[model samples]
Target chain A: ELKVEQNPLFLSMQEGKNYTIYCNYSTTSDRLYWYRQDPGKSLESLFVLLSNGAVKQEGRLMASLDTKARLSTLHITAAVHDLSATYFCAVEMGTASKLTFGTGTRLQVTL
Target chain B: DAGVTQSPTHLIKTRGQQVTLRCSPKSGHDTVSWYQQALGQGPQFIFQYYEEEERQRGNFPDRFSGHQFPNYSSELNVNALLLGDSALYLCASSLYGDYGYTFGSGTRLTVV
Candidate 1:
């Protein structure tokens, strides 16, 4: 079975600080996705990283995939309260893209 | 456009009972996948349906089943529910061969 793990399951950051959430997987698929979910809400797609060295950015968030290392990272820049939420990284199993997700990192940005 | 939508936003059922959750795929989507999200956990893939056929399934038991209609909508049925089965059930939709998925808000099931 494929296992995905994320570090620092809980994070508390002050405004203007940057942090990175790392997702390490046990397999070799290059397809990865990042999603954000607020408490009691559904997941919102953040980025779809499809290949090694693939990087995507939107506003204060950026994501990258390093398939060769079986790793992916979600980087938060200049943290703000509005950006606080749980972030998940999912890796596609095989070419079919059936995602196996990590435990997630709950981020709380405060002033 | 309106995204993927799931019905019965919340439900409560007694153990040993059965429950059905419905999902309508996003406009122009041709595949539907169901996932189970326990409290504070990432969504786990349950199954995927395409062309009215079940194409893939996860490690779940047979008691968890699903069906897809010609319209690409889907239903997830859980029988003989256990307390562990109570969670947020999410339905994700996408085009065939498309890696990106649109997820629904999910149905919260509580077993009493």
Candidate 2:
């Protein structure tokens, strides 16, 4: 069984601060994905890290994957209130694209 | 191009009843996957369908079943529902063998 764990289940940070959410999985998988979900909304794809040392960045967010360590990270740079949401990291084990998701990190950015 | 589409934004059901949720894959996408998300938790994979067949499933019980039409639309059926079944049901679509996915807004199901 593949188990995905994430830390800092809840976070309350002031605007302009920075933080990193960690996702650790128990299996070896090369495809890892990041998603963000707001209250009452579906997930929004953040990044798709397909290889070791893979890193992708969008405004205010950067995600990286280390396949050898079976770990992924979502870094928040200079947070804003609009950035508040629950972020999840998922591991895809096979070609089927079935995703085993982490517990999720809920971030709340305040002024 | 339209993204994934799911029907019945919300539903209410009693224990032991059955519910069916629908989904239409995104344009040019040939795979569909279903997920159940509890409040404040990450979404759990229910199953994935490709080429009109269920290609993979998660750890969900047999009470949860699904089907995909030739047009790439899908339906998720849950029998003998329980209060614990209440959650948001999300549908995601992707191209076969492609890692990129697009998710639907999800159907909120409340089991009483």
**Compared with the real two-chain complex, what DockQ does model 2 have?**
0.80
- DockQ of candidate 1 compared with the true complex: 0.75
Candidate 2, A34-77: lDDT as tens digits: 99999999999999898999999999999999888888999999
**Mind sharing the TM-score for model 2?**
0.98
Which interface RMSD values do the candidates have, in the order shown?
A: 1.2, 0.9
- The lDDT values for all models are 0.92, 0.93
In CAPRI terms, model 2 is classed as high
Top-scoring candidate (DockQ): 2
lDDT of 2 by residue, B1-112 (tens): 8899999999999999999999999999999999999998889999999998999988899999999999999999999999999999999999997678899999999999
User: What would the per-residue lDDT of candidate 1 be over residues A1-111, giving only the tens digit for each residue?
Assistant: 899999889999999999999999997876898999999889999998888899999999999888889989889999989999999999886554578999999999999
Residue pairs with clashing backbones, model 1: none
